[model samples]
Target chain A: MNKIIFYNIFRFIVLVFIQVVLLKNISLYNLNMPLLYILFIFLLPFNTPNWLLFFLSFTIGLTVDIFSDTLGLNAAACTIMAFLRVFYISITVQSERLETEVTPNLSTMGFRWFFFYTLLITFLHHFFLFFLEVFDFTAIINILIRATLSTLFTVFLIFTAEFLVYRKKVR
Target chain B: MNNLWRFISKYNALFLFIIFFVTSIILFIRNNDFQRVSTLNTSNQVVGVFYSKVNNVIKYIHLDTVNKELVAENMLLRNQLKASHFNDSVVVNTVTDTINRVQYQYIAAEVINKSVNSRNNYITINRGSKHGIQKGMGVICPTGVVGIVWNVSPDFATIQSVLHQDTKITSSIEGTPYFGPLIWDGENSQIATLTDIPNQINLKKGTKISTSGLSVTFPKGIAVGTVLKAGVKGGGSFLNISVKLATNFYALQYVYVVKNIFATEQQDLENLNKTQGNE
Candidate 1:
């Protein structure tokens, strides 16, 4: 348990740094902005307490928010994503497997489950992020396109990072 | 009591989520106001110091571009000085010596952090109140207008870039007396919309757009952009003029904060006029 906590703490710091110092500068023809910090929320232990999940997600979002100079947009998006992850996991994973599953990663969860799970949560987070960031209904189409492109880019990066970190798939 | 406790514990996550989410939304909205001091903005000391340190190292990578821009600005300044010298000689021979009073002062600052991808963009500069930087001052690059100082701290300031939705600047087409408010449509950083231009005036493509100087924020003839396209709006007497902004926001490094000497006097007079009109 202590080892898992230590690993998560280190992961949080690394992801935040990468997102701020590296990813924030990358814009592919000004179409997509991949926000990879949300990956921290996605990789939490399977049976972590819900309240703790919400708190941790908010903290990470706020930290990113501070670096990006966006006061609350990230916090709102991450909190909702954390809240929704509970439902997303419950419906997808079997009850009997919940006890045995260590964490939802590229190695622990099958490719199909992990891919779809990351996609859905990332899409939701990006959509909400762009929505609040724009806060204007007149540019709905612009918001949608930006959200979709960013979601795709973020999910692709997350998948690549997961594969690189965990060499072999357990499932 | 037991039932209440059970319900609270059962739905703890939902309650926590709502609380956190609502607080964040409030902060987002409140921080958007020009008058508010955003805790997370780079103007804050901790954030400002970190960004400045990072920028100090990264700026070396763009030294060539920065040098070229500086050289161009230097040439322009030298030409202006030569013209001013010629005028001074003319004044020296005049019967009545006209004293030239300076109205605006420029405070140089370096951009430590900036964003162009978001709908509402902001740039953080290294100068702050300690350097005489203040909210409502105009920030301009060597080539064109950049933004307005929205918040200021002791050592840094945040500029609400013209790319933001709420930002509007008074601009006019070159060689024409007509003026309108320039606004960003949030689609592209390079393009902005100039509205409230009367439909009767024909604006040709490539016409120069510049600061109207109707407000104290900017002086007359400061380069803003050129007319990319112009068309009539659906049900208005105005033309929707598209302008290609002159400043490349992505490559912005150095800027000047324009301090209008008569801003307070102008604002006070306007307020007095409004009150008198109400009566």
Candidate 2:
């Protein structure tokens, strides 16, 4: 339990640093702004307490918001992501494996489950984020285009980061 | 008591989620922009220190570009001095002065941080309250108007950049008296929309657009942009004008904060007019 707490704390700082210091400056063809920091929420230990999960999600989002000068967009999206995550995991994870699964990382959840999990969460996060950011019905097409492109870019980056971290466990 | 504790434990997650989510939305909306901005912006102490440190390193990489802009601005200022347009029009009148006093002063600041991608983009500058920077001051680069200062800390300030959705500047064509509010379409950072020009007016393409001096923030006659293309909209009475903004926000580094000395007086007079009309 203590080890898990320490690991999450370390992950939070590293992910936020990578996000604000590095990824914030990168864009693909000036269209997609990849947000890989959402991976931190995705990789949290599967059994993290509900209250803790909500707090952690909000904190991580708020941290990104501060650096980017996006006041509450990230925070609101991440909080919604956390709320949905509970329902998602309950439906996706098999009952027996739920007890054994320590975390929702590439190594622990297996490739298929983790990939699908990340895909769904990343899509929803980007959708919510872009919608709130645009806040206009007239530009629905613009919002969709941005949300789709950014989600793909973010998912690709998240996959790369996960592969680099868990390469040995892949086999 | 036991039942109450059990009920709380059973639905604790829902309760917590609602609380956090609501708070996030409130902070997001920022009903009182002034109050929310000062405390939450990058200019605040702890966050400002961290971002400024990073900005110090990043600014070095763009040193050449910044220097070139400074050189260009210097040349422009020198040319204006040679021309000296301000005093040229001053009439020698003893009883009634015709030339209005310069109502704006400028404070130079460096753009330590900025984002053009977001819907409501903001730029942070090295100047703040300590440097006489204040909320509602206009920020402009050498090329054109950039934004309005929305928040200020002790040593840093944040600007609501022209790229933002909420930003609207009063502008008009150079030779015409017709004016409209310039707004961003949120489609391209370089392009902004000028609305409210009557359909009857023939707005030629490539006409120069400038600030109307109708707002307390921006002084009249600053170069805003040029009309890219314009036409009457389908079933609309106004011209659909596209303007190519002069300032390239992506490369913006140095900016000037325009302090309007008469802002308070103008606001007070306007308010007095409103109250008197109501009475």
Candidate 3:
């Protein structure tokens, strides 16, 4: 169990490095949102304590923020969404409690609920990040436009990561 | 005491929402840009190494296109040389519009795999340390700006294309010195937009825009594209202009990765100026 936890932690750190270092440099429409690192937050155990969840989420976000230097915007967005994830799981699958560390997917929960849940939170996280980066209300439409486009790309990547990492054998 | 406890229990969700919102706001306020830039700088150094590898693999597949660009450039240079001898002052404008200025140099390279369909489009080039490429180098085609070099390996380099998300260049109009941020409009690849040009600056539809050398990534006067549309942004202090990029990345082949010999000195001087201003 300890080895598995360490491996997962190692994986999370590597993803954060790739997401911000490599993918952040790739921008389209002025949006280079990170998708690989979010998987770190996605993969935490189902019944992890709330305080631990907050701490892990903050640490993950703070680490990313350290590399990107956009303040703690990533940390804030990540924590809020991590908090909401509890609600998403409870609403989507009756057996969400059964799997202790299942990353989100259609195989575990039906496609419809999973899609909606991912879509909403991803949008929220991206929207918040972009606005916080731009940090100006003079162009509200520009903010929304950036948020919308970034959300779309981030969503595409979330699924791509899931497809790569998902395994039928949870063990 | 019982009434207060009950009230707190009943409204936990609302409290959570407020607490979360306030925290985000604090983070937003605290994340000033320059410090964040340094963090990006470090990651830029590390990840830049990885993409350089992918660039090599894809470049092998696109040799034909790269050769074509080189051949075309050689022909244009040949033509210009002939014209220069005929008329000592006014050379034929085949290779460049600016005669005698030597505003740019060429380092021929090949494009491997590039993504324009994604929100962030990055292009990988086949030249790296083996070919004298490094990070912060500017890339151009015979047409215009390709991208800025972000990472480098022994045999390959990766660039953040102008078409990528949040990638902005400082640029000025062909005949005027007005500067603004040239950015890609998310919806389309053919068109990128410029912002922060004061509204007083009149930009025409056909104005040629080029890099301003405001940032270390690109040198001044390298071709970027031509303005397609110009406008005064709504209730803003600047004119929002759209430019059509000269390089047809969709059919990109060989590119030139340009290096500025004195880039390190220039950057240090610029930083010193900024620090002095703060005091």
Candidate 4:
């Protein structure tokens, strides 16, 4: 438990640093921005308490918000994502499987499951974030374009990061 | 009451979610309002220091371009010096000129962090209240107008960039009385929309748009942009003008925060007018 806490703390610091310092400057044609920091929420332990999960998500989102000067935009999106994450996990992952798997990652969850999980959550997060930032219906098409492009870009980055750390199981 | 307590305990997660979500939404609304209560923002000391430290390293990568821009601006300033031009007017023994009292003072600052891709972009600068920076001051780059100082901390300040949705600058076409508010449509960073210029006034491509000095925020006749296109929209009487912004937000580095020295006096007189008119 102590090790897990330390790992998460380290991950939080590294992810926020990379997000604000490095990834913050990179935008594909001033449209797509990869928000790989969301991976911190996704990689949390499967058995993390629902309340703890929500709190962690909110904290990370608020941290990003502070750095980006968006205030509560990311916080609102992240809370909604956390709520949906709880619902999604309850329906999909069985209690028996949770005992063996320490956390959800490419190796533990398999490619297809992990892909869909990141895709759905990321899309929803981006959709909410962009629409909320714009706060208008007239630019719905532009918002949709941005959300879709950014979602794909972020998912690609997540997959690349996951592959770098992928380890084959010696059964 | 017991049943209600039991129900609440059972759905505590939902209640927590609602609470957190509502709090965030409230925060978002408060942030969107014109006057923001600054806290937990980029202007905060910790966040500002971190960004500036990081920018100190990153700024080197653009050293070549930044140097060129500074050199170009230096040339422009050098040309305006008295030595650059022969004395065109008759040399008169001049006393201290009482006619032109300095109305504006500029403070130099460096951009530590900024985001242009977002719908409402903001810039964080190194100088803040400690350097005599304040909110509502106009910030401009060598090329053109940049933004307004929105929030100020002791050592850092955040600027509401021209690319923001709520940002509107009172501007006019060069050599014409027709003026309107310049706004960003959130589509392209390079392009902004100028509204309320009547169709009766003929506009042409490449016509320069400049600050009209109508608002107290910015000074008079600063280069804003050049007209890219102009036309009537949906049978409206006003010509919808698109302007190519002069300031390249992507390459922004240095800026000048313009402080109007007589702003308080001007505002006080305006307020007095309002009170007397009401009677």
Runs of candidate 4 with Cα error greater than 4 angstroms are A99-101, B1-12, B88-94
DockQ of 1: 0.70
Rank all candidate structures by their DockQ, best first, as comma-separated numbers. Answer: 4, 1, 2, 3
Per-residue lDDT for A1-171 in model 1, tens only? 888889899999999989887798887666699999998999889878887889899899988888777888899999999988988888888888676528789888878988999999999999999999877788788778888999999999998899798857466
Worst 10 residues of 1 chain B by lDDT: B86-95
| Local lDDT at B127 for model 2 | 87
What is candidate 4's CA lDDT for residue B83? 91
Best by TM-score: 4
lDDT of 2 at B73: 84
DockQ for every model comes to: 0.70, 0.62, 0.21, 0.75
Candidate 1 structure quality by residue, lDDT tens digits, B159-198: 9999988899999999988999999987888999999999
- Candidate 3, residues A22-83, lDDT tens digits: the string is 67556665444445576677667666655666667767776665444344667787877777
User: Whose lDDT is higher: candidate 1's or candidate 4's?
Assistant: 4
Docking class of 4: medium
Please, what is the TM-score per model?
0.94, 0.90, 0.57, 0.95
- Per-residue lDDT of model 4, residues B201-221, tens digit only: 877899999999988889998
lDDT of 4 at A61: 91
Best by lDDT: 4
